[model samples]
Target: MKKQFAIIGMGRFGSSICRELFHMGHEVIAIDTDEKKLSLARSFTTETFVGNGTDESFLEKIGIRNFDHVIVAIGDDIQASILTTLHVKDQNVPNVWVKAQNDYHHKVLDKIGADRIFHPEKEMGSRIAAYLTSDTVLDYIDLSADYSIIEMLATKKVAGKTLIELDPRKRYGCTVIAVKQKHQVDVTPDPAEPIKEGDILILIGDKRDLRRFREGELS
Candidate 1:
């Protein structure tokens, strides 16, 4: 299904999102106060508007409330981002996703009812740190404060076991959702499929359990 997304601000973060969403077949409206930025976004977005996103009248005129999702990606100007987010919320947009400049900015957005808060730089840094720190962990995605999904290289001990034999959910509190081999991926991997040394297991569970699993308890 296609979704209508309004991206406020045309800086790197916002522009990247706009282009990706456009490519993914979503209807994107890119708005920016800078003429140059708006011009750059015009080719990638379904619609491009040059205006101050913090202006309530301008936002209303552009029908921001109609969008399925609204993203406030203003950079540097935390004030503008907050005001714009507040205005968008007042208009009763279904989902509001905001980018925070820092912890303080995030707190304010949280208070104002932002449906989702994103700290892209901090998140990217964490991802890079995870990759650098562990050879076994291929990737990490936070599902919630208590839960996470991780991709890990299968160790020698786990190589020949089936899902039923390993009993990940009962033993480690994690479920093996899929397996990624060199050239193929098996979604919802079968219980009878034997794990291989080079295969990557996609597992989902509580963060603490994932940490324990990474420590070779399941080896």
Candidate 2:
């Protein structure tokens, strides 16, 4: 299903979100105070608005409450970000996500009822650290503090081995949730299926166990 997303900021982070959501076939409204930024976002968003998001009058006029999700991505302006988030929540938007510049900003957003808070730089740093750990790790998503889902490309160490032989769950405390071979995806692959070189594996496990598996076995 498609969603209506309003992104209030046109910085790098906000623009990226707008572009991705638009590409995913969702309705995206990009808002920013800078006309230049809005011009850039116009190509990627369903609509682009040049205005200060902190202005409640403007927000109300634009019918912000109708959006399924509203993202407060005001860059550097902490006060504006908080005010925008508060106003958006007051309008009863179903989901309100905010980008925080620091831990303090995160705490403030938490107190103000942001459904999700993202620390882009910090999160990306952790992801890059994971990539540096092993070439097999293609992508990472944190499910929680202790759990994660990782996309890994099968290498010589893992190729030609069946799940029963590898015994990931018993040996590494991880489970291969899905496997992608070429254009096909096998969500419920047989345990006896042989993993081929260059196949993508979607694995979920405790972070510590995943780290140990990547460093000790896959590396």
Candidate 3:
């Protein structure tokens, strides 16, 4: 399903998101005070606006309230970012996601009713570090401080073995939630199913237990 998004900045991070979302077939409106910065997004969509996103009237004029989700990707200016997010929420947009500049900025966004907050740089750094350290890990996500989910390429070590035989839950203290073989994904795979040599296993567990699984099973 397609979604309507109002992106309030056109700097590197914001433009990147606009391009990805456009390619993903979402209706995106890009806004920035700088025409040059905003122009970077025009190739993606014609719904580019030149205005102060912090101004409630400007946001109202753009029909921001009607969008399914609004992203306040403002750069550097913490005050401007906070005010823009607050105004977007005030307009009653159902999902308001913001890029947090720092801890302080994140706290303010949290207090102001921003539905979701993220640190892109910090997240990307952790993901890259995981890839660098592991040869089999294809992706990683931190669900919380103690829990994580990871995707690992299935290797010969586990080939032809059934889930019950491998007994990940009992042995590794992790769960095999899904397996991706090429384009097809098997969610909650049957325990009797045999593991293939090149499938991808998606597992979830406590972070320390996941690490133990990596060292004990996926080594």
lDDT of 1 by residue, 1-219 (tens): 456889998998888777767764668899999989989888889988889988999999999989868889899999999999999999999889888999999999999999978887865423433443356888889777678788999888788988888787888888888899998999978898888898898999986687676665433
Error of 3 at 41 (Å): 1.2
lDDT of each structure? 0.82, 0.83, 0.81
Residue 15 accuracy (lDDT) in model 1: 83
lDDT of 3: 0.81
Q: Which one wins on lDDT?
A: 2
Sort by lDDT, best first: what order?
Answer: 2, 1, 3
Better of 1 and 3 by lDDT: 1
Model 1, stretches more than 4 Å misplaced?
124-219
Worst window of 10 by summed lDDT in candidate 2: 124-133
Off by over 4 Å in 3: 124-219
Alpha-carbon lDDT of model 1: 0.82
RMSD per model, one decimal = 12.4, 12.1, 11.9
User: For candidate 2, what's the RMSD?
Assistant: 12.1
